[model samples]
Target chain A: SQTIHQWPATLVQPVGSPLSLECTVEGTSNPNLYWYRQAAGRGLQLLFYSVGIGQISSEVPQNLSASRPQDRQFILSSKKLLLSDSGFYLCAWSVKRGQPQHFGDGTRLSIL
Target chain B: AQSVTQLDSHISVSEGTPVLLRCNYSSSYSPSLFWYVQHPNKGLQLLLKYTSAATLVKGINGFEAEFKKSETSFHLTKPSAHMSDAAEYFCVVSPIYNDMRFGAGTRLTVKP
Candidate 1:
């Protein structure tokens, strides 16, 4: 069975600090990875998605970016965090396009 | 382009009562639709998906949804609501490739 894992389940960061969130998939290969942010009591906003290593597409322009270094390892990073960056960060993986995506336990980030 | 709309922002239902959460979608092609549930501060889990197969799709936890192409709707339903069913539900749509869109989630509250 395929599973996705994300780290630092919750984080409190100061403004202008750096941000890094990692996501990895187990029992899956060459899976498409995605980064999403959800505001409190709101819908998910797609931030970035990657098809393969070093390939990423940004859906909404933001202070964050995403990278795929390995086949199943994805990273979401920010050079300097903004207050608006505070939200619930979620990582997801899909075997194929138009298929259901599997999500990891999200990282609740609070920027002060 | 594909997009989903979850009509209800929140719904309250008594235990053992029928549950209904409405969703509508727009897609350019034969789209793939999905319903997902998210526990508080947890990852999103797939409830069901419709991909040009049967209009009625059954998912985990005794949940089901009907895909009505003419109405462009895919509403989730359950015969009896359970306390454990209290969560956020999302409607998703995908047209072809990495063009997945999510609806603003609907929060389901099952009262005892």
Candidate 2:
């Protein structure tokens, strides 16, 4: 059985502050990791995805950046956050291409 | 390029009635389709998937979806609706690769 863990289920950050969200998977190795953001009354938006460690792909360019430090560890970071950065951030993992993805509980970030 | 479109932005149905959420997809090749459910304030959960093997796929929580290649649609269906079933549903498509795309999502409301 595999499980994904995301830290800081809810976060409140001030404008221009830094942001870091962590995601780690257990019981699975070399899985594809993804980062998504969902705004209020909107759908999930892909931000980044990683097929392996140290290899990251940015889907939508913005202030956020993602890094895969380990085989099953992914982190989303930003040096300075913008007001539009506040949203529900989700971390997901998939076994291979065209497979179903497993998602974490997600982190609700509020920037004020 | 792969994309998905959910026909309805929001659907309201009475409890114990049949439920249907329409979805259409576009892809140059054979596409892999999926239905995902997200409860309020929770992570997205895989409901079902169609990988060209079976046109009708059954998923958890008594949900099912049928894939129509000619129509390029994958519509979710359930025999009966429950109050607990009220949530947001997303239609996803991937063209034999890991580049998964999600629709805007359709919010289901179960009325008593």
Task: Write one digit per residue (lDDT tens) for candidate 2, span A37-75.
Answer: 999999999999999999999989899999998999999
In candidate 2, how many clashes are counted?
0
Distance from true location, Cα of B82 in model 1, Å: 0.4
Off by over 4 Å in 2: none
Q: Which stretches of candidate 1 lie over 4 Å from their true place?
A: none
Individual DockQ of the candidates? Answer: 0.84, 0.82
Worst 10 residues of 2 chain A by lDDT: A93-102
Give the CAPRI class of candidate 1.
high
| lDDT tens per residue, model 2, B87-108 | 9999999877666899999999
Cα lDDT for residue B17, model 1? 100
Per-residue alpha-carbon lDDT of candidate 1 for residues A33-100, written as tens digits (9 for 90 to 100): 99999999998988998888899999888788888989999999999999999999999999877668
- The DockQ score of candidate 2 comes to 0.82
Q: Would you list the clashing residue pairs of candidate 1?
A: none
